[model samples]
Target chain A: MPLSRVRIVLIATSHPGNIGAAARAMKNMCLDKLVLVRPRLFPHEGATARASGAGELLENARCVDSLEEAVTGCRLVIGASARLRTITWPLMTPRETAQKVVSHYDETDVALVFGREHSGLTNEELDLCHYLVNIPTNPDFSSLNLAMAVQLLAYEVLLASEEVTPASQQGQLPAEVEKFEGFVQHLEQTLTDIDFSDPRKSDKLIRKLRRFFMRAAPDDEELNLLRGILSAAQGRKSMRRDETSKE
Target chain B: MPLSRVRIVLIATSHPGNIGAAARAMKNMCLDKLVLVRPRLFPHEGATARASGAGELLENARCVDSLEEAVTGCRLVIGASARLRTITWPLMTPRETAQKVVSHYDETDVALVFGREHSGLTNEELDLCHYLVNIPTNPDFSSLNLAMAVQLLAYEVLLASEEVTPASQQGQLPAEVEKFEGFVQHLEQTLTDIDFSDPRKSDKLIRKLRRFFMRAAPDDEELNLLRGILSAAQGRKSMRRDETSKE
Candidate 1:
């Protein structure tokens, strides 16, 4: 019952195979409920074969005449977006939106709606959602496959529902605050000692370094190893200073 | 040069529009490297139209006869998978996989290979990959549009390489391990106090809860609020226990 509460709605899907693929994507994530609005083709051989083992989901999919009818009675509606619209709406990242949907799983019916393969959701269709769900994609190449978007969002939903767990973190640990802070302090001191940055004017340099490390997201051992390198640099600088002073 | 080093290889793609769409997706993410292996049609009107502003990418796209030729010198090769096979290869989620690809960006060539529109990569073709990348999707319905997968993975590459910043995190910070672990311990204690899980046999439940929160990835403030809720629940449970003892 809760599974059915989370509905995957595809509007004006042009390719029957994609509709089947979308159904398969939903099924892969243990989602059975699918709603198709004005799809160009359904009950097609291509869709059935593409669905593979997920043909049952396609068989049970609700094909509606309109977006309005597809999402009727749904208390929470989320439209997946690709581009920034002329009219901006409240937008949540796919991860955040999936959590919201899963959290409200018991209380209300939720619709995760997708637009056509070519144009994506129209402004009018997007207006019906409580908020938009935008997958953080490459700005230069933001075109996502219709089924891939469904797969990503549905994966998040499955994850939020605690139906699945990632294999493991593979022994890599996230950098802790203390370790990260230590690395930053070590890097700053090394830079200052080496005259790479003047201590008094290192604010901007420090900010750049912070951004670099944050983007890299080094693990604990990696941070420790880097700190070792910085310490060695500091030692080398001090040794050079000693020689220059003696001369 | 690193951007050029990361190649998008489509093996035997069928539709001209998908090829165009794939090019658009690559351009949106700032990726210029595209290799088509034995596509059904190329230089078609439909592909040109779908490419839209990314015509430059399609113009420079390389058409190769074999996957080996497309990825000949790539030091790292990754294949995208929608289904599991008998022999499991080392798999990475799209996010982790993208991070790996980006980390190697400056050093050597990398390839992100996707299969055909109908039947995906064959076992023989997949053997060429160093590892497999699986986008977690609905187990029942794991159909992903090829271009969309490219977009999401390319987006991660951009993020990891610091080529682009997300629009914003809306003030939510990434959770440190200490904070995450603290929240987990609090949740487990509350669950125990409320008799939600038997204290002795709660290891599996606790593990599941951990996965749920980890996937949800609530920021520090959100974690604090959740911890507060757990504390309140524990307090209420203690009060109830005291009343029952008195009775």
Candidate 2:
């Protein structure tokens, strides 16, 4: 089976539109399968409406009751939670998660499970899975929407897959989330290193750049290319400075 | 000039209660630096009550007027939003926003700016930020309390700072998301393709299943793993079905 064999399951969804949106997210990554556990509202126009253009996925979804039945034959169960619990399996970042799940493709069934809207997967439900996956989020605000989480992971999967390459440009691009973030972090370090973080601006130096790049929203691939260029230029400049000083 | 330099700023916040709560969230994530920009009513009884003993955050809270004063020297300004398009800067979801801010922490002071309760950061106020941060929410109802959003992003920054992940465990489980989600999705498709819909139980089946997975909440890495395995199973099942059809 190909990656298409995977399933994305949602439990106790309260909003119908979320189901549709989740379908859209999955489809955006070419994932078609969607399962709903217990929803407060479903088969509602509101939900389908929210699904936007992803109606096909919504129409082709599966509805289940118990968590057990939803994943009866699932050899691997991966749960989502923001909490760090006393009793549970090992947790992996999304990137690691992709590798582990793909590793199990030949051996058994697998399930990507999520909990409700207001509250996330409880400790009890997490026990079903051999592993847990946590999105690297701000601890101050860690609640991610069901569909958004699916979209984030789905995007990561595509990145990790054979189809993935640095988003093509003349040079390598920092398109991956973590990879791009690394550059941003590195750039910040460079600014601090150079003492160019204009203090008169009251942190305005970095804040403006955050706004600029965020608005610019460089794709990971593009970011890498740019950063590489930047460092190269900086490296040359620094070498010249060193030579001049020696003279 | 590490992430320690990044400051979370709340501006013209109307609710004293939310202010206290926000402090708690930041503290939990190990972020102490907070700046209040033109709070409507601060040092109020409500703020202290809601703070739940996180008085240090409030006591040490820097109170300033005008967004200009709050973010004067801050190099990076990230504004949180749910609605689209009114601000000058391009928008980013909370996750991306967090990463963007984190990247700039070393370069200059980064401000995680939040707006008023009545309407959120105004166009003018939001214009202060270089980038707008949107938390992915149900399109129908994407509103998240200010404190919750703070908690999530703060958590991510802490993770970013630590860099080192603990040995894999339930708290940080390594899931196989792709396979599990794929299985759940395939199972749903099978039921649909096979016409297993019990009219009365259709909703029940879907909802419960979704909730179950929600509880499972698989991460990015695991999803790819599950998808590979699931598509495999579905591929085999389809092949069998095709052979039977030929007969």
Candidate 3:
């Protein structure tokens, strides 16, 4: 019933500041129970500065050497990751995981786990959970911080616990800005490579091209498919240009 | 139900980019309704520039002058602020606010209010809200960037809607990384509410706390339930602090 009871654990956090930020994130969402496993550098300056005033979470935090011990009694364990693995588990978003926890509100404890900043949760760590929580970033570059993963999951959990009967209109899910940006960047690079972009007007041309996609409002899956097509087109363009340039 | 249709309002924002970012934040959370009340700048070049692909939120954002007008028919109004004023509104943390808003989910409209970054809401403005949403931050410095405030509320709305349950569990349910970071920030705010974390030691404790929770690998529902408890506790603390300071 209280955010304080839901335990949140971080594993091998390298930067203390990120740890602080992660605490800040949980506190922002009203989650308080915190546990750490084998952190590299804790009780450091960056964290508190980053944590700002949400430092109380840090004071009561429990640190352990092993992840298994961190979540011993937990009825549900959600592993946060940037990438998907071959490991078999009920994959759930942080939101779904939160719902699972709520469904078992009868359970005494629940856990939301994250991994090191550099590599994220290991397969062994991810396998420990009943479900895998992924943040779904651009596949080409999906490195997310520990705190960020927590914040997203926390936000969803809060909403699920609410009483509102949603109007339930599935609005058009928009394209992710990061993914759109990535696709645009790739397209820009591709255009430049094909000599289709005149250096003088390339910036304007690229902006216009970006605008075209932005207007379309493609979501993640759509954006990915668009990028794939563009990449293929650009690849063909590259071959033709290379042949002509050599000749 | 679904998170796609939450109405997010920003009052008296100063920066256009923040507006743009707020739009991006809403999009990240899957909350598309963005209403602005007398932002210092809107249809702002910098804001749109920063919004990246969330231009649609900007394009569709409803601009108004009075807070009442922005939320006239709303069944619920939750205000965002880092500072507590002498006058009180029913206080709630962002997570609690999200829950409260959703409780009114059957209503045609729900508005989560955010004030300017500099001063937050005035007593008159707070009066218009059914609830006051306090973002717990560093006691010494608790000001969140306007976009960050928007991100927190938007993330909660989005999480409340769809992040909790995804059709597929193999990947993260399409939430933006930056928005997730905002939730982390709000989590940190909670410790500030407890007033136990000294500024000097705040950073270390906060990071350790993040380390603790991030390691838990919470799912969306678990994270929300945790945050909801913490946010409610902070809201009580925030209201209490305001009462004492006023006397």
Candidate 4:
């Protein structure tokens, strides 16, 4: 819900589909507020069709004639730029911008302003911004689609928001050390039974396998599954031994 | 360039414009390899117009009949999924996936696969992937445009690729996809032969095993060791069968 305080402002956008796509991208990232300044077209079918399930955002978007009007209530304004300007401005990467927005979300409303698809924000439009955010791209082909740019920034914001939240560690808990060691022992025993390794000379091989599985950091369930497979392999070897003894 | 080793694959894309936009997005991120699997429309004007300055990518894009053909020669295969599946697979965030790709760039060819625009990837298609990458989105409105998804992922890859240094490259190279598949098949046969699993009912178990091994990311030498163990296990089973027949 912290993203509610952040507003996405598009300046003089030419393509209606870009506007719709931007709205969809914003909604996907949990940011809702949208302001269009001097859009060439709005309420067009192209926009509606492209918005998909995010039509509500376009319906609730505010239209303003000037950049100042669009960002009037914002305490912090960040301008998105693809080009490295000659003029001195506090430049930030998308991740830095997201961090700034997240840290300031409780204190103030933030505005992230994007520019025209072809020309981008003019000097006067950029002067109103406290910082300029640039998405790094290949130097030769630096042109990113307007909506795609929105998607990238919004994604960074979403990730940043999750990091700051208390419940960010949602992944499964890793297995305890004892349980993991047991699995390693089982693996080593199975390897020996299958004649894949000799107990005296298999230390290096076991160590390598240990390092790899340690990096994977399997959870309890994964560890149990692994132990089951080792048992199955061992079970096969014992069954073979019984048949040979009977012979 | 490390990114040159990364391929962007789109399967059964519906919109031509999305294809063009995806090409542009890839070019912007310095990734050029593109393979399309059964796109609904290609060589269309909509895609050409959307590609803008990146028309060359669209022109050079390889069109294939299936995902297998599209991902041929890749060592690592990562599938992008919007919906969280009931069956557990090793899931990675876009940033983590990007780091993985960049780290493995020196050792292997990587493929990032995206599925249909409306339905996304099928479970069977996902079975072929080593990992599932979920782009975090608002739970209520999780819909993300195909091109926009491609853009965000490519953006993250570009950033991660820039952060990696040559000295960071360590560890053994992973086995090729074909070899990995062969090993999986061998393990399945061994499991059946050992009477531990029935081929008809072991899909879920095999998938779990696949997920675990994929997370461990075994290299050629490690995979060879694993396959050797499977062969040894199968040898015991076949020997037991022969002894029983003689009795």
Candidate 5:
């Protein structure tokens, strides 16, 4: 519900595909509100094709003639800019901006604005924004795709929201220490049965193996499977010895 | 330099524009190594047009025939998956995977593999990966664009690389995928020799074992030790067979 308070606004977008892609990106991060200001083309086949499963977002999007009109009801305005302007404005990274939006979700209707594909936001358009959000990039090549910028910011917002919520713990329970030690003992015996190491000199190798497996933190099922493999391997040698004695 | 060591591998990508867009995203993040495995089309105008200023990466991209070849010589492989698989690989969020790669930057050449646009990586391809990374999305509509996935991951890698200090070295270098595969092959043969499971029906068990070991992520030395043990076990059985033949 906090994410729903954050709206994504695109100003004078040239590519319809970017608009659709942005919509899909927004939906992927659970943000549905979209405002487009004088986009060069909308309701085009390219936009629909790129929207994939998010065509409904496109159909529900509000279109306006100007940035001012787009942010009419928004309580907070943040502009996404690629480069710093001569007149400095408060700039925050995407993560910082996401935190700001989520923390202020209850009190504010937030509008996160993006600009055109080529020139980005104009000085006048940026002036309307209370703060600027910049996604860090290599100085030499900062041409981030329009939709990608949306994806990154939306992703950060989703992460921030999730952080506020209690996380669900999944995955199997780890193997008990005693059981782990039993597996280790079985592994050592199997190594000796195969003559891979003399028991006295194999301490370091066994320790290294132990350390490696310890990093994995295998669960009970995995440990049992490992023990079974060791048993099968050791059983083969014993069976072979029995046959040789019979001969 | 650490970021340079991170390679983005796209498997069976269908669109050239996505490839181009991915290159631009990587360049923006200061990552340039691009490996394409069985792409539908390359060097196309759509890709170049989409690449914008980062066309040089596309021109210099490495095209490979298989995923194995794509990840050759890499010390770590992480697959990007949209949904959780039935047999869960070690799952990490993009940020966590980025942290792992950056912390291990000194000793590891990392490969981040993205699967096809529609269906993600096959279980076989995933078996080759040490970890699976999922970009958290809205479950109702989790359709993430291919290049957008690349952008999100590359962005995280860039952020993590920037956070790396001079003294962040953390673990032993993981074994190269090629050598890891060799150990797995040797392991399968050893299992058959030991009569642990019929070769024809051991697929699921082998996958389970592979998943367990892949989670451990042994280094080159540890991998060699595993192979040595397998060989020792096989050698003992061969010796018994030879004695029986002589008799």
Candidate 6:
């Protein structure tokens, strides 16, 4: 649903092919809203050729002269930036930005504004955005292409919207904490009685073993089975103690 | 580590701008390997301009005549496409494809092959790929730009290699099942002694409880505490039964 409201805004694009490519990238991610601010060329053969079959997107793309005009009604504006500027803005990774966009896209319009081919968005242009999304790149050669940046951002947004269900959420409910605690107390007493664990120095061992079982997260059957073993051990230890006393 | 061994191969690229853009995208994602197959133009002004400051990538780009030549030594080859062809090939989403690339990258050369702008890879070209990578796009307008596709795939690979640490793996080893089972049996016996559960009909409830506890998966101390409660409950029930008999 957010896919329909999300817009791709290109600012002062120098090459016509980039505009075409940007549109194509949007279309690939199921994002069709496009706004171009002060593009040097539009409705060109090179753009058409590069767009391949997605020329319709370029045809419908809105061309505006100013960034202000480009984002008139948008509630959220995100600027894609490659540089670490002197005046630091709230910086977010592309993944984080995508999450924000996906969450707010359905309720309000969202704009992902990109800058020119050579120099990126000016400081003034950056100020217009609520956050600057940085695509982590190789520090030695961090030269990301304009269309490619759009593609990465758009791809992430699409992924977020798809809402891939997490493995944990799939129907299995865990036991209550109180019940599990009861089982542990008996086990420890049994261990101490059996001389498997010394109460005075078993703190470290208990912590490590606790960590181990906590990670495993056994269910009721599993937990019950474990408790049964501990009880049996305790019963056996008590019998042994009685026999020793008699002897 | 696979980042160094991965190669991006573009087959018969007609537009120099795309090549430049692809190079820039590669640089931004920390991927440096580039292979061009019989491009129409190389060392062109358009590509240099589009590459922005990433001209160094273009300068060192490899140009070969044939696809086979381009991917001569690569151990793994992946083809990018938006279409589902007649002969069905094992298709993976960009994320899945990226995971494969990252995993195999360290041990062998991995080639991500992109076809010409107009018509993507040929059937013959696709035959060379172990799997075809598809970016999930809007079915209505699935027109993704070549460089943009490259960028999305590259971004995913970079993310996978970053290796976000899973919480479970950080610490806390899981408890063994056999230990956990012993506790369950003891608890069951105590419940039966206290008349909390009918031995024959309680199987269903016991199974459900087992599942519940299994999901919760308490720590070592938790298990011990639970067993102690069961032992106490059993003792109290036996005392009550003896009192009732005497009365």
Per-candidate RMSD, Å:
20.1, 25.0, 25.7, 4.6, 4.0, 16.9
For candidate 3, lDDT tens digit of each residue in A95-185?
5666665555443477888888778776546535556677644333345445656766766665554533233422334443345557777
Off by over 4 Å in 1: A12-21, A38-56, A65-68, A86-88, A115-127, A138-148, A162-164, A168-247, B12-21, B38-56, B82-89, B115-128, B138-152, B158-247
What is the DockQ for all candidates, taken in turn?
0.10, 0.06, 0.04, 0.44, 0.47, 0.16
True-vs-predicted CA distance for residue B195, candidate 3, Å: 64
Residue B163 in candidate 4, Cα distance off native in Å:
2.5
Worst 10 residues of 3 chain B by lDDT: B238-247
Task: List candidate 4 segments past 4 Å from native.
Answer: A165-247, B236-247
Candidate 2 wrong stretches, greater than 4 Å: A1-76, A79-88, A94-127, A134-247, B1-3, B44-55, B86-88, B93-96, B163-247
Error of 4 at A147 (Å): 1.1
Off by over 4 Å in 3: A1-5, A28-30, A83-87, A103-108, A135-145, A155-247, B1-27, B30-113, B117-119, B123-149, B156-166, B170-247
**Candidate with better DockQ, 4 vs 6:** 4
Worst 10 residues of 2 chain B by lDDT: B238-247
Residue-wise lDDT of candidate 1 within A80-177, one digit each (tens)? 98887767688898779988998898899999999998898877787799989887666655766677688778767876787466642333445898
Please, what are the lDDT tens digits per residue for candidate 5 over residues B1-247? 4277899999999999899899998999999999999999987998999898998899889999999998988888999988876664678889888888888777768899999998989988998898888888898988799999999999998998888553656567778988888888889998888766668988988898888888888888888778877877775433212233211
Question: Of the candidates shown, which would achieve the greatest TM-score relative to the real structure?
Answer: 5
Better candidate by TM-score, 1 or 6 = 6
lDDT of 2 at B86: 48
Q: Which order, best to worst by TM-score? A: 5, 4, 6, 1, 3, 2
Q: Enumerate residue pairs that collide in model 5.
A: none
Of the true interface contacts, the fraction found in model 4 is 0.60
**What is the C-alpha lDDT profile of model 5 across A29-111, one tens digit per residue?**
99999999999998899999999999999999999999999898788999999886777799999999999988888897899
* Predicted candidate 6 versus true structure: per-residue lDDT over A1-247, tens digit per residue: 3276888999988878778777777777778889999888887887777676677888888988888888888889999988777777899998899899989876898999999878999878987899999888877766576777888898888878876723111223335687677776776676566545557876765665555456445556556756654554455322212233211
Identify the superior model by lDDT, candidate 2 or candidate 6: 6
DockQ measured for candidate 3:
0.04
**Shift in Å, residue B84, candidate 6:** 2.2
Q: What are the runs in model 6 whose C-alpha is more than 4 Å off? A: A40-49, A164-247, B40-49, B86-88, B164-247
The C-alpha lDDT values of all candidates are: 0.71, 0.61, 0.63, 0.85, 0.85, 0.72
TM-score of chain A of 5: 0.88
